[model samples]
Target: MTLSLNDLPLRDDLRGLTPYGAPQAPLPIALNVNENTHPIPDAVASDILDDIALAIRDVNRYPDREFTTLRESFAEYLGHGLTPEQIWAGNGSNEVLQHILQAFGGPGRTAFGFAPTYSMYPLIAQGTGARWIPGTRQPDYTITPEEAAEQVRTADPDVIILCTPNNPTGTPLGLDVVEAVYEAARGIVIVDEAYQEFAPHDAPSALTLLEGRPRLAVSRTMSKAFAFAGARVGYLAADPTFIDALRLVRLPYHLSTLTQAAAVAALRNSDVMLGMVEEIVEQRDRITATLEALGYTPHESWSNFVLFGGIADPRATWQQLFDRGVLVRDVGIPGHLRVSAGTEAETTAFLDALASIGSAS
Candidate 1:
């Protein structure tokens, strides 16, 4: 008598939903997730190991409950005049986001984001017992000031999330749209800037808009640009009061000693860890250009991945690429697929494999 999930009691809201994750296959060239794909330079890896070694010596005691030193290091690294008092972190950006929802969202409250954005937003809302509302985006995936403001005013949600350089679509949101949404809404506005390091240097970040806005938060992660995805470090910058609110819901000593130590060491070598961004951006642009030449419509992207359309059979093409020892994402968009920008050699391998599959037309 095997007990299946259907036979066991489960939460009503979660009973029918599938878990969120990309497909995983063992392939020689994997560009499915937007990982940095570059190994940490040897010197930096050695430094991180040394720091982790030191942290383990204190294993007999609980780690810092506040993770004070790690917060300070993050403040210095972000430097839009941010301070330790304005910082909050968790196991990953997802957990940090979960803390936000726990503090401000619950039954009768609603969380909002544009449709076709990160899939986790809705799942996180559901898990927190909040309703999820998905707004619309332009056909090209960009949202305008008017559309955003109107939607926020109408939804009047408890928490609003805006994903710049949106995942799966690679669309970049404008700051003006963010401002409009913030003004029209009565709740918190979170800007998920997971790919900020890959954007142009001249671009202004939502951090510039944080000083006077207490309900605004700009979240970042070391996963993409720092090649620290495995380190599980994600943080956000916001008002001290907002940070205090999260503290109420978070578990004691949420970040372990080893995690804090590795993140701090990586921050210490920020220049070296970030040196790969320029190269990754180059490969992203290369992918976009080659995609166009190959007769696909590659959407404009400021991040380290390219999402191209014109695929006649997305799943088959994905499988063909998989069979050829390369892996890319079939992100559920009809006639389209997304591929992360990898190392120079890896990028060539992906592009060559894609070429061999022939044009989607």
Candidate 2:
């Protein structure tokens, strides 16, 4: 007989949990996840291969527990007068976030996030035995400083997550709003800058505000802009004190030798690896313009993805795109769907599919 969840013991809090990710359905033109999907330029690819080969030679030995060199690479790349002491790495940003929760949140603690944001913030907090508090955002998905500060005051959570260029919505959070929340909350404030590289030229990163705020931390990842999702490397910049706290919770040698080597190679070739960003930005704007012309309401995006509304039925629209071999995300919002900016050709293909189909159902 097959044993099911009912037959085995599980954590009471996790008894009814479904997995977090959306379906990774394969299709001709996949614009679902907010990934770069652009291949690394040839020279960068060659260097990365060499680094991988070098890392495997030392694979028989345990990896570096502190990932010292990797931390140094991150510091150099970030270039805000940051040092290795303030850098931290993990398998991905998710794991880095888990470290934050494990160090500062648990049991009696609680974490809060403004919703229609990244789904994982609450899930990660709850996984650490901390309660998750959901907050609200305006209809356009922007959270004003007043609303944010009010929520922070009311919940008084231990960890406050601010996801700029928020996932699935693609709307950015303002630095002033971040400051307001930080001032109102008594706990640590984490700014998830996973989409920072894609923001418009005038938009500022919360990293600029790190000077005097010891309690503020900013999270980033290689997966989106670097086209290194398969590498599974993510990192953050923050106070040395914050880094010290995360160290207590992270497993020794958490980042493998291969991951460190690959990430370092990518960082060293940052210019070439990031060369596609401008082109992708163009593609994102093209998508927005096309969507508007096609009568959909596309949110002004500072990220690599566009979130648009005005669909008659999101589920059917998702299916319509899927049927056409162009996949986009049905992010559970009413009358809205999200799609990532792909290569120029891929973007055209997605646009053509949508334009021909019109509103689905």
Candidate 3:
């Protein structure tokens, strides 16, 4: 006799909704969920361990309530003339986003994002009691400045979220669109740049646009390029006033001592930690090229994953790859699947497995 949600007290809006996540399975090669499958270098890992051990000694006392040193490190790493006063962080980007919603969105306020964007936007909105309004995207998944501004003007939401180098589909977003959307909306605007470190070197980040725009925020994470997903540190840059708002909503001393210490150690070794990004990018491009040669339409990607279409039966193909011990994502988008760029060996395994299954006829 298993009791379900109907048998218990639950929020009506969340009654039938499922949690946001990808399928987890043990496989020899996993490219799903867009994780950086590369391991951190040994030297950096050793340094992190040393820091964590020291932090453990202070476990009896609460960690820094302001996390001042961590914020300063992030500001230096971002290098858009940012300062500690404008920085905010949380356990992960998701928690940082939750704080935003809690501060600026709730009750009658509405949050807006382009459809087929990050799935968590709506869930976070719902959790904060904010109405989630979904805008549209072009057929190729790109959005122009005019279209984006028009949508924002029409929805007139209290919050707007933009995911650059978007998830599930590897579409790149231009800063012009961000500017236009910001001009059209009177509310808070958040750009989720969790994958920004994987973008092209010359590409300008939204941080460059944050100079005079007090309503804008650019959020990033150590999960992908730094291979720090297990460490769970995410941060954002915004106006000092805006950061103060998140402080109002964030739990007291949210980041643990060990977490701050580990992240600081990683940031200090930023160059060495990011060295793996080049290799991962090579594999990502390789996946794209091989996918096209197989008659699949691979979208141009700035992130470390490729989303391809032209699968005759996505579920069947996914199962075939899984049977071969190679796992990719079927992101619920018809005729398409996504794969993260793993180590060279893992990428080879995925490619071989995909090639064995013939292309869509």
Candidate 4:
């Protein structure tokens, strides 16, 4: 006799909700997703093809579950003395976050972060049945140490997530503030540095804070800087013990042989990748300055995007831009929109579109 499955509770939290998916549109300047607008350089493309061909030979077997070589290469590129055992790889940083939630979050636990930051943190927490507590950021979109520490002490969350160079707002959390949170956190503190490549002056990475903080994990993604959004490679750097806990929850042979090879190839040519980053940063500054001149107050961004408000109505402004063949991200925050820095040509087109609209008005 089949047991009555209908009586089972559906986790109680995730019931009646549709899955999240990014909106699709015809690719017009395509600056909504914060992707690097530059295509892979031809020389780099050739190198990646060579590496992928070599990796194809190993396709018959499962990839090294440890992903030792890739992790070591990444550590070397980052100039950190990290071992393969101290790292974990996944399809994307999003998946890595899910693994963290599963390993460290559950009922009676809470995950804390600053609101108007990365949109994924709360979703991940809720998916795991953990309480999500969002602290408010300062008017400038920066978080204060005292505020974060107080939240940790009062809420006593089991996990804390900080996104340096935060999304949709493009503001970087000060290193001092991050260190303060690290000191005060009761459990795991994840520093998600998905946009680190665009940061000014090589801001201190959370990897430097990992020696004493066994509860810290720093997540990175190839999708942003390396322009491998299509490849879907992301990794975490943490203490070996923390990585082991992540290992327990991650699927076996999760990183495909192709992805491993692509990451290694991307890491090996980091100098080329950095050149592209320089270009993007230069373009970002130009865009920010132009937006300010247009009377749009954009946040000081260290990422490859600029976020601004005061468009009268953000949804209306977004609709206007879309009508002009430009697609931008209109975050639900009133009068706020985030636009990625694209190639010079794309930036010019976006500016031209906005100018045209302003002139028509």
After TM-score superposition, what is the CA distance of residue 39 in candidate 3 from its true location, in Å?
A: 0.7
Position 226, candidate 1: lDDT: 93
lDDT tens per residue, model 4, 85-122: 78887898999998999999977789998888888788
- Error of model 2, residue 231, in angstroms: 0.5
TM-score of each: 0.99, 0.98, 0.99, 0.94
lDDT of 2 by residue, 1-361 (tens): 9987867887888888887987788698988888898999888999999999989999999999989998999999988889999999999899999999999998899999988888888889879999999999899999889989998999999998899989878888999999999899889999999999999878888889898999999999999999998889989999999999998888888899999999999999998888899999999999999998899999989899999999998888788889999999888999899999999999999999998887533
Candidate 2 clash figure, as a count: 0
- At residue 257, what lDDT does model 1 achieve? 95
Q: How close is candidate 4 to the true structure, as a TM-score?
A: 0.94
Per-residue lDDT of model 3, residues 20-96, tens digit only: 88888988898998888988899999999999999999999999999999999999999989999999999989999
Show where candidate 1 strays beyond 4 Å. none
lDDT of 2: 0.91
Which lDDT value does model 1 have at 331? 81
Give each model's clash number: 0, 0, 0, 0
| Residue-level error in angstroms, candidate 4, position 4 | 21
